[model samples]
Target chain A: MTETTLLTFLQWIDLVGVLFNAVLGAVIGRAARLDVVGLVVLAIMSGLGGGMIRDVMLQSGPPIAITDWRYITAALLGALIVMIVRVEGRLWDRIYPPIDALALGTWAAAGSLKTLEAGFGVLPALMLGTITAVGGGFVRDMVLRRIPGVLGGNTLYATAALAASLVAVGSWYLHVPTIGSIAATAVGAALVLLARWRRLSLPVG
Target chain B: MTETTLLTFLQWIDLVGVLFNAVLGAVIGRAARLDVVGLVVLAIMSGLGGGMIRDVMLQSGPPIAITDWRYITAALLGALIVMIVRVEGRLWDRIYPPIDALALGTWAAAGSLKTLEAGFGVLPALMLGTITAVGGGFVRDMVLRRIPGVLGGNTLYATAALAASLVAVGSWYLHVPTIGSIAATAVGAALVLLARWRRLSLPVG
Candidate 1:
């Protein structure tokens, strides 16, 4: 694909990731029995907080999510949808994990790419990428007064993000095409979903 | 005071504020029964997170705390102190609140001054100032899986910060001597301690 097309595709992925995280945040807010304001706050924070943190750390000026209206709008829409529809029962239970895995992978890839574009070194880029993927959820969990799933004894969340970020960063170093990064993201998401399905977890001390 | 002396005084206040907050953070970590690593992480984050966030938002590169090793060393010392000598009982409790209040006020003043120095408008300065003051405690509470003391119905913690920030920002705008800002911060801390002593709080809805 052309450069413009690739960029557009990447933007779409980023948007999708944001939306998914927003929905997940709203779901958690609902579980916490928070008010509407709380739900919306959590949604927006989860959707954009990580990227904002990363950008700030990168000294990249005001975060793009803040400067651009679309990201906020998307987060608001996702929150509204979740609040209005109230997706529950077995269906949501079955679908939530996969959607979350997809968000994790996409965000990790996008963050790594952005870091690379900023001309940072490999380790910082990879670390920032994982932070971007998990930071939002961490904020959400914190707001709800719970240990973050990534830090707690849960399925491999940060590990998957790290894997996806590594792929994206490695692809850049190897001079792979942009499309290769997307494939790597997909592989990462697949790994997360598979791990969840198999009930796999990293050993704890 | 001369400009050089005034600046030196302000820097000392800033250091004291960071150390106070770091001790409070370590105390909270111990209360949570966290390991030494968790204690140190919480201390550093509480001491530096707010300033880092403010600097990032202002597009100030590499947060001053990260550049100056003193802040990190102070935080480490605070954590180590808490880890080695367990402060408990009613006497420790009585002292903790006042120290925390002092930290809050100084941080609020410092953050507002920094924002003003960055040439931001008054409102952003005030908001960022309050954020910087309360942000470290917020992170600590979140990591411990408890509702943030500021967000929860408490003795006007964030309000005190805002009040201090307003005083600082207003002092700068009125061309009051820099020492006036220190007085304002003292007043802010006094108000918080008074509120706590009186069991005062903002009414919950």
Candidate 2:
């Protein structure tokens, strides 16, 4: 594929990631029995909070989520769809984790690329990328009065984001082709899924 | 007083505010039974998180908190003092609220001034100012698994910050002299203390 096509595909991946995270946020809001305003707030925060932090850290003008109406619309639409459909029960329980992993990897890769493009060093880029992938969920869980999944005994969620970010940043630093970066993202997402499937967790003292 | 004297005084207010907030954060961390790392993290977040957010939104370069080693040192010192002193019992309980209010007003004023200097409009300046005052506490409370004191019933804390921010931003917008801005900050701080003394609060629905 052309370079333009590769970039477009990556953009699509980011959009999908945003939507998936928004849905997950809405679900958490529902479980918390929050009002509509709370649900919407959670949706937006979970969908874009990390990217907003990244953009601000980079001093990259107004965050894209704040500027682009499409992103806001997408997040709100995800919340609305979940609210209307009420997608709970066994089916959702089975599918949610995998989708969440996909979103995490995609966002991590996207965040690292943005940071790299803005000329930050690799370590900062990797850190920001991991933050971008996990920030929204952290805020959501905090609001719900729970320890953030990343910090607590959840599956290796943040570790997955970090892994994806490292791969993406490594490829960029090596001047690998864009397609190679895309493959790295996939590898990261797969690792998250594998960790989840095997019930892997970081040990706590 | 000379212009240099006035600037130095304002800087002192900011330093005092950071120290007060850091101590409060350390106290909370102690209550939560967090380790030394957690205590220090809470202290830094409570002291500098709001300013970092404000600077980022203003598209300023690296946050002053990150660039200035003095700020970091101040926050760490606050945390260490709390750890060593363990100021609990009646004395701490009585003194803590007033100092916390003082910090809130000072931070609110400082945040408003920075926004005005960055050429933002009055409304954004006011909003960012209020955010800067309360953002640290919000992060701390979130980490501790509780509703943010600003959002929940907490003795009109956020309201006081907003009031202080409004006065400060209004003075700046009116092109008042620096002394006038200083007086405005005083009035804001006085209002917070008055609210606390009178046990005033916004009514919950």
Candidate with best TM-score? 2
- Writing each residue's lDDT as its tens digit, candidate 2 over B52-93 gives 888877776867674555676788788898878967889988
How far off is residue B202 in model 1, in Å?
3.4
Off by over 4 Å in 1: A1-51, A64-138, A146-205, B84-86
Pairs that collide, model 2: none
Model 2, span A142-184: residue lDDT tens: 7777766665456677777878888888888788637655865
> Which is the leading candidate under lDDT?
1
Q: CAPRI band of model 1?
A: incorrect
lDDT of each: 0.79, 0.78
Question: Candidate 2 has what TM-score?
Answer: 0.62
Model 1: lDDT equals: 0.79
Name the DockQ score for candidate 2: 0.16
